[model samples]
Target: MPVLRQITTCTEPSTVVIERRVRTRDRSVDYRLEVCRRHRWLASNWTGRRSAEGSGGRCGTVMDYRPYAQIVQSHADLWLRPLAANGPEDHDGDLAAALRAGFEFLTAHREPTGVAIALEHAARITEAIAAGALPLVEGQAQVLAALSAAETLDAGARGA
Candidate 1:
């Protein structure tokens, strides 16, 4: 194993490796593991510069270790759905529900990035509603009140 180490762990658990180098007793055994999709292979075929004289230990130099990181990213890509290009119907309760779901999802999923995403979604939905999306009725005061509350919450959060 080489004393220098590099570790990369992605949000999607995948690849991992440990490396080290040693010099002693006129000989040393350097060990390393390269893993990908349950595949394991030895890289012991390396032992020095292609045309160096005297003696030198292999595994002390850096090499292309990207294959390991690529494995981890492969798993992360599977976890998220691609946003649709056409998006939801421009004028339907279904569109409201979908927009509401996105706002809800953004709030419930508290990432370090914060809940700013939810506020943006909320604003977009409100804008759509104001543009004669779902016709407002005199008796829709209840709905408007609820929307006001949600807006106030989002505004307070932004100020905080």
Candidate 2:
């Protein structure tokens, strides 16, 4: 097996790294997922290397590989839910804060060019929220749309 590429995305408490490898014989793609949460790690589709601890290796246990989109969607959902939830009177402020935090995190990990769409969407959402133009539900929809569009664009770039 030859290593291919790896991408990482992060939100507050978690960071997910997806490594894509291809088998030379059949040209099949294999996804290896690694997640870090508050300094703890969980990995899937591990390479079967044993650690000194020998408890299935560093990440604790191994799991089967999952589709790339599935992994991205799950992580996005987990991170985006709070932006959709009800909050105090300062809900819009909270939403803007959340968006800013997410944008910063994404910027730090991924290339600004790669995540330009997401950054644009986040700016729009926060601007609307600040200007009192977006209600909670509409804001959530826009966020979802933003993520969908970004994912679609990324997939297309990858020729997937």
lDDT values of the candidates? 0.32, 0.42
Model 2's alpha-carbon lDDT is 0.42
Candidate 1 per-residue lDDT, tens place, 61-159, comes to 222222322321221121111211111333242434444454555556566222334333434645565676654442133233333343334434543
| Per-candidate TM-score against the hidden true structure | 0.24, 0.32
TM-score of 2: 0.32
Candidate 1 C-alpha error for residue 53, in Å: 88
Candidate 2, which segments miss by more than 4 Å at Cα?
A: 1-115
Q: How many backbone clashes does candidate 2 have?
A: 0
Q: Across residues 1-160, which tens digit of lDDT does each residue of candidate 2 receive?
A: 2222222232232244434555556545354444444323333333333222312222211122434334333434433343323221234435445544555555666665444456457557757856889985566556545654554344345433
Q: For model 1, which pairs clash?
A: 1-20, 1-21, 2-19, 2-20, 2-21
Error of 1 at 93 (Å): 5.2
